[model samples]
Structures are given as C-alpha cells and as structure tokens.
Target: MNTSDEVRTFTVAPDDDGVRLDRWFKRHLPQIGFGTVSKWARTGQIRVDGKRAKPDDRLVAGQQLRVPPGGDAPHKKPREKPALSEAEISQAKDMVITETESAIVLNKPPGLATQGGTGTKTHVDGLLDAFAPGEDEPRPRLVHRLDKDTSGVLLIARTPGSAAHFSKRFSGRSAKKVYWALVVGVPEVHEGVIEAPLAKQPGSGGEKMHVDHEGGQPAKTKYRVVEKAGQKAAWLELEPMTGRTHQLRVHCAAMGNPIVGDGKYGGKDAFLTGSISRKMHLHARRLIIGSPEGGKLDVTAELPEHFAASMEQLGFDIGLSNAEPIRDDPPPKSREEKKQAARLHAKQYRKSRKGERRGRRDATTAKPKPKPKPKAKR
Candidate 1:
C-alpha cells in the first residue's frame, strides 16, 4: 500500500495496541521498512496525535495516527526462484530420513543451509517445493533450524497448523535436542553444567556470540565427556537447557575446550593435525519432539562422513555414538497448565518473602542486654 497520493489517518485496533510503532506499520503496511518509518518520524512526516513519535513508541488503542501517503501500491510478494533441476530435487530428497503426515525429519548435510538468506540461494527450504511438484499442496515450512556447518536431524512442518504445534513445543522447552561434538581438549570434569549467560558479540556482524554475565540472556548447558584421546581431544554429548544462538559452541569455548574445527570461536586451536578433517565437528545427534497428532517423534541421525573420520582419527570409540537416547518423551504442557504453574510460582515467592520478613523482625526485636549500672562508682 505505497501508491497513495494523499495523507491518511487511522485508529489503532485493540489487537494492534501495545505493539511498537514500527510493528504497527509492518502489520498494516508490510512494504514499508522500519528505516523508512524512522526517517518519516525524524522528519515529522509521521505523527501521533499531531506530535512526532519514535519508531519504538508503544501504540495505544483509539489513538489517532497520521501516516504519510505511500499505501496505494500493490504489496510485493517474495520473488519465486526458478524450479529446482532434477538432480537438485533428487539430492534434496536423499536427505529425508523419515516423514509423517505432519512432519518430515531430514538428515541435513554440512554446508547446506536450512533457510536462505543473503547470498544463500540453495537451502533445504528452497528445495522443499520439489517434494510436491505439479501439486497444489502448500510448501513445507521449516519448524526449527540447525547451523549450516552442523549436520543432522532437522524438522519440517508440512502444514501451517503443524508448524504452529511444533513451534509451540520448541519455544515452550518441550522439545528435546541432543547434540554431539568433538572438542579439542578433554573437560576436567566428566560431566557438569554450564550456566553462563550469552549475548551476541559486538561488531561481529551477528555471526558470533560470547558469554556475557550482564545484559545477556540466561543460558545453561549440560555436557558429558563420553570418550577422550588422552588430554588432546574428547567426544562429548551436550544438552542445552536453554536455547541460545550457538549455545553449545559458546559453552564449550568457555570451558577452555572449544568444539573441534570451530575456527570462529576456537581459532587455530580448534583444529587437529594430520589426516583428520578440519570440518566443524558438531552434529545434531538426536531429537525427541511431540507429534502433532499424538505421541512423540524420536529420531537419531548418523554422523556425517567427515565427523566419523575425525572420531576415528582421534581414537574415539565409535560405539559411544550409539549410546541410548539421552532425552526422550518430552511431554508438552498445555497453555492452561503453564498459566497454573505461573500462578503457583508467584504464590510461593510471596510466601517465602513473608517468612524472610518475619525472621528479620524477630531478630530486630530481640531483648537488648541488661544495662551494667554503677560499676564506675564502685
């Protein structure tokens, strides 16, 4: 809606209230980027109640908003790429490990992205349309992501409803993801937790993360050393208690033993000498997630060729990779159950605070020592 020649005023709907001004525009006028909105606000072209507003200002229901004209143009949809070649289609199909009515599990390979981005033309998401060529079915959507260099079990939702169901499971922490990595050095502790918070590293162009205690999101990881090659390298199974970008990589680095071949975080120390492949030695080993129709989907992906070769070279027991599933059958909580849990947590917090205050009051009101009288006169 960017072709309008005249200014327009609109009232914020209840659904639109409390969202940032930029979000409001994105909802009603998808074509207008936040940059344009900010420019308009800065130049007094955009106003709320005749006053200039910031892009981040929260919108209120019933507020009068003045929008400059650019709303008449037809909305632009993403450009559709040419159809995948037969070879490319076959290649993508080969990656699929299994499929259900609602979901597809893929053993994604290294160096292949899950989704397309800047200069990323070939990815799993782009090739999904090849699965149902010449059909009217909707293209499958990616429910979650794995790093391009990290190969293994990636999930795709076949329908919008299924996507919503799976997204909720992941965001609510009901999905279980187990990763395996070969680290450059054995951890001092056989098994332990990493509870450091994480945030994006500044000026790294959003490609790197660092452990930041302050102003960072809480992140936790549980790791176990499965096998070791003396003090040089180790095979580790990692479970992320809280999902953050590159949480496993960052936590391993923080432990003074970065994942092997992760040059970004580990530098040259990430590599192993000799015949071992220097490709990133991380893999998404297993996933246990709730199914849309019923129970759980438990799947394990075999390691890629390079990873297996590296494990062999490091003298790591390949049998350790076949160990029993670490996490299984994660039951998803309903929205109502989550609400009840929040209420209970608040009640417990209030009760504990009251008890603490009572203990402090009793200590403060304790009787003072009896005064010593006339000792000086005696």
Candidate 2:
C-alpha cells in the first residue's frame, strides 16, 4: 500500500461525466471504502469545483475534484468473473425486449430477482456476463431496479459511461416509467394524483412500506383507470412521479384499492376469488428515457403471462391503453423562479391595498349627505 501526504486534484473525464462522486472513487480509487469517502464528504474535505460536495452529487465533465490524500494503493487488477453456463446465457438473451448500442431493455418476468441476495442464486445480474463486451470493456450495469415479484421493462446499461448517463436520468426523475396493474377495486376518481409520504413499516425487517405522512419521504403517483371489470377489479395505468421503494404498491393500497395479488401490502383482500392469477399484477409496461447517443430510448415490454391471463379473464381490452406516452407534468419551479413569483405576488397585494385605501379616502371626502334631504320630501 502506498499512502500520500499531499492533496490531489483531478478533472472529471467525459466518460465519467454524470457519475456520482462516490462511484467515481470506486472506479478510479478502489482502495478507498465508501465509509471513508462519506466521512470526507461530511467534514468538507472533499470539494468539487471549490464547493463542498456530497457523495451522491453528480459530477460534470471538466469539474475539478479535490481529494485529501491518505488511503492510496497500487492499482489492483479487477477480479475475474466466473464463467456462466450456456443455460444462463440463453436465459439472459431470452429476456431481451430490445437492444441498443448503449442499453438493453429486458422484459423481466415475475419472480426473478434483478440481483442476487441470500438464497437468490438465479438473477439478472448474475447472467449479465452473457452480455459482456470485449475484455477491455466493462460488463453491463443495472441503472434502475424492479421488485422481484413486479415484472417488466428493466434497463441495462451497456457501458460505464452509459451507466452513469442513465443513472443520472433516473436520479433526476427525468425518466418516465409507466406501469400496468390490476387493483382490487376502482378508484372513485377516474384519474388523479396520489400524493403521499411513505416510510418503512416497523417490524417487517424493512421488507415492507406504509404511508407515513408525518415522517416519510414524499411520493406521488398519477393513475388513470383504463377499464373496470364491474365492481370487482380495475385495470389502471400508473405513472409514478417520484420513485420510492414499493411506491406503486403502497399508493394503490392507500387509495383503498390494493393491487391484485400483492399480499404483502394488502393481505387477503389483495387477491380476487376467481381465475385471477395469484401473482403480483404490477408490470412495468413502458420506459421512456434519454439515451447516451442522443435521441430518446423508448421501449415497451410485453405483459407477463399471469397479468395477460387475468386481463383476458376480466374482459379487459388491451387496446383500451394504446400505450401512447402521456405528457409529463412540468418540472417544479426553480429557486429563482419561486422567488420571482413571490415578489410579484407581494407587489400585486400591495397595489390592491393601496387601491382599497384610496377608495376609502374618496368615500370619506365625498359631498354625499345632500342625498337624505331629498328623500324626506318624496
């Protein structure tokens, strides 16, 4: 290990452009642990362009990154990935809905984990080796995630640069993801926004979430009822405005119409009595996002078997939702724009108050009382 006593500064490369500050360290300075990087950021030791920066802050090309030196090591070779079997490679390729130079859109099926965990041996990440490029190129990376039970459009970045690009779009909430789900009941309102704050439910080992308005992260979902099956269930087009863990599930339950087959959030009520499949009905139907190569990368995934069967059983028309992309609501006002609006409102209020005062003064000064004398003669 070689330690450095002097500070070091490096310019962000174009390839590293939209990556998080911490991820940059992982790529370029593997010797440093995430905890150390976080501590440095918290204490103001790490600076980007002369300003204190957070570990999650996105880095731009040509930005100067100041690093305080202590942990430095000679370059270590990356660990070789285990060779995947032919079966695994076939499984991975079978899931691809569309592929581009920078991305691979997978129509992920239900019950398959995106990445591995305890007892999770088969996963999309494990099979990513099938898509590996040349020996010098990095393996495809996951830009976003979907629940193991909720299936549909999953984007995989083909390179580190594209990974960084896609990750930034997701974190900035610029990417639009549309979901299709069968909920237990129809919402009284056909279309509206569900704005609720969510927090992890207690005692579920952080495996569950609930609406916790008082102390929770802000979450919003815009839902439209595409069709209904009498009073039994409704097919909904859901667009989550803010991404949160299990956001769509929680919001649907919050509206008193839990998604079909999501027993974790809705319990027994989540399932229907008939031929409806007992699998979670949430499917990520479409994704529209900017590509690294310039134009938008819009892809739609076909519905999984269970969801499709349920739709047919419920007499729903697939054509009801043409899957035409809906326009996103305008972005929130910037700080300067909000300040300008406040100033304009204040000016208008002051002007109205002045007009009221002038009216009062004019009424008081009017030669008005000649009026009552003529009424007595009449």
Candidate 3:
C-alpha cells in the first residue's frame, strides 16, 4: 500500500461509491492527510478518470483515481481503551432481532439514539462495533435512521457493498417501510393521504418543521386507521412516500391529531390521560427492502413496552394482521426522464435570469418624472 515513492491508481469499488474524494483517501490511503490531498487537488496532481477532481467531489463505482506519491502523514498512536465497552457490546448484541451474512435487523428501543449528536454519549452507531467478526471486518453501516424516541426495526449493512446497494434501494424509494402509531384522536377518514409540503422552521436550529406549501419540498404520507379507542385515540398505520425529516410527526399533527406523546408537533393536545405512558408511540413496525444478494429482506419489529402497554390499555389489538401493506409508491425515474428534467430546469433558470435582466433594463430606461410641477407649486 506504500506508493509514497511512486504514482499509483485505484479503482473505486461499490463500497466507495458516493464517497467524497477526501474521505476515500482517509479510508483507503490513511497515510494521506487532508492538507496533502487538498494540495494535490489544487495542483491538478490528483485526478479521477483523467480529470482533476476536488476533495469534495463524489466518487462513483469503477472510476479510477490517479494518486501521486508523497503520502507521508504522521501516524497517531492507538487509543488506550477498545472501541466498544463491555456494556455497549452487550447492549448491541441484545438489540439484534436477527442477523444475516449481509445484514442485521435490530429492534431498537425508544430513547436510544441511532447515531451520536450533541450531548449524546452513547448510541447505536457506537455499539455496532460488537458485530465486527474480526479486526479486518468492515464496520456495519446504518441504512436509515430512527428518531431517538422512536423504536423499531433498524437495518445494519454488514458489508460496504451491501451498504451501497441498500442505500440505493432506499433513495430510489423501492424500500417499503411501515410504521404504527397511536394518535391522540381518530382521523375522520378511515384512509387518506397528507400532501403537505414541509420545510425547516426559521430560527429553530433545525429542530422544528412547518408546512410551507409554496417553497417547501414535497412530502406525502398515506395513513389508515387500524383501530380507534372510542373518541380518545386511534391506532394508525402510516407510510411516508418521501423521506423528509419529521414528515410523519408534522403530517399527523396537520391532520388534527398528532402521534401520542409527540409534544414537539402536537403541543399539549398530543398527550392522553389515564394509565398510558407519555413516551412517543411511533414504531417502525416492518421494513421490506431488496437485499444486495438478490432477494427480498422483510423484517418485523415488536412494539416497545410503553407502546404495547398503551395498546393494551386502550383496547387496541396487539396481534399482527395478515393484510398486505398498501404500496402506491411511484416508480423510479428513468435515466432519460431525469435528463429531460435537468434540461427543463436549466431552461427555466435561464428564462428567470432573462426576466430579471429585462426588469432591470426597464427600470433604468424609464423616463424621469416631470420636474416642472414642483416649480409651479412653489
């Protein structure tokens, strides 16, 4: 791997697809530092497929990277403690509902964060090291995220190639996700769609979202009422068509009854009285996605204790149904369709710029108001 004295080329594998050039170096050629990569990129010494590439440029599968010599970055000593603690290892092992050669399905518990963030000391990503079969094994990668307070089936790709494949399925909307939530009240319609657009609330530090029909990105959620607890609450099966942040919470709230215990979106109305717990009742009930190995990977997760207890208290059925989940998902766009869309967007952008220039020219070319009126008044 020491090509420090000679030029070398590397082919990007499926594992490295969509990875930034700088990140690729960090993973494949750790001896290269950020400064060295930046210098090489700036000087046209680092090339991707015969073209100079930037550090932030995303690499694709089968692309060749031409690397120049001089990767002499200093090596740092290893940390004293092992990556995973004993408790974290146990927690990670206990959370696994099932495992395969390419994937592991976890029934994540509520309040356990999927990844670390500010003020977060422990999380699923940190605990995943326990699943490593050997020191040389690639660390498991999270295919998707579950909110810190939402528990359910979470998929971990055991290999980088699997990670790349699963990621494509999710981004292409071929992956099917079914969620169950207990809301504060029953929706009027038994089944319906929420077509509200959502955007981040200004000044919330990205913590809140609101409907911004005019300028927001499109978001849609399809929901059906599985059961209702009189007028107090309802059990809903929800499927989000787009993977917008907090789309489910916002959509449910917009429907006049938010998921129970979702205080952020529903405010005080999201709560319910009696023996029911105040924990969020949303769960990722099932996930059906095409595996990298060429078959379907379908897994179901059981509800958490609080969610199950609430169901029992509210007289909702806790058993699984044989009914197939509804999937009206749109098909992935064809390559030609995507190219046409890009062309259309470019044409519209040019038209908009032309209009702006015309408006400016008209304003500057306009005749000045007659000055004689002021003198006559005086």
C-alpha lDDT values of all predictions? 0.84, 0.89, 0.86
Candidate 2 segments exceeding 4 Å error: 1-75, 325-378
Q: Is candidate 2 or candidate 3 better by lDDT?
A: 2
TM-score of each: 0.66, 0.71, 0.71
Return whichever of 1 and 2 wins on lDDT. Answer: 2
* Residue range 174-264, candidate 1, lDDT tens digits: 8888889999987866666889999999999978999999988999887877888998899998888787999999999999999989998
Candidate 3 residue lDDT tens string, 5-71: 7888899986677889998887767667899899999999999999999999999989999999776
**Candidate 1 error regions (>4 Å):** 1-81, 321-378
lDDT tens digits by residue: candidate 2, 1-378: 256788999999777877899999998777778998999999999999999999999999999999998866547556578788889889999999999888989999999999999999999999898898356556899989999999999999987788878998999988989999999988866667899999999999998999998999999998888899988999999999898999999999999999999999899999999778999999999999998878899998999989999999999999889565544553465686578678879888999899899999999998966545454654
Better of 1 and 3 by TM-score: 3
Error of 1 at 290 (Å): 1.0
Alpha-carbon lDDT of model 1: 0.84
Q: After superposition, how far is residue 352 of candidate 3 from its true place, in Å?
A: 39
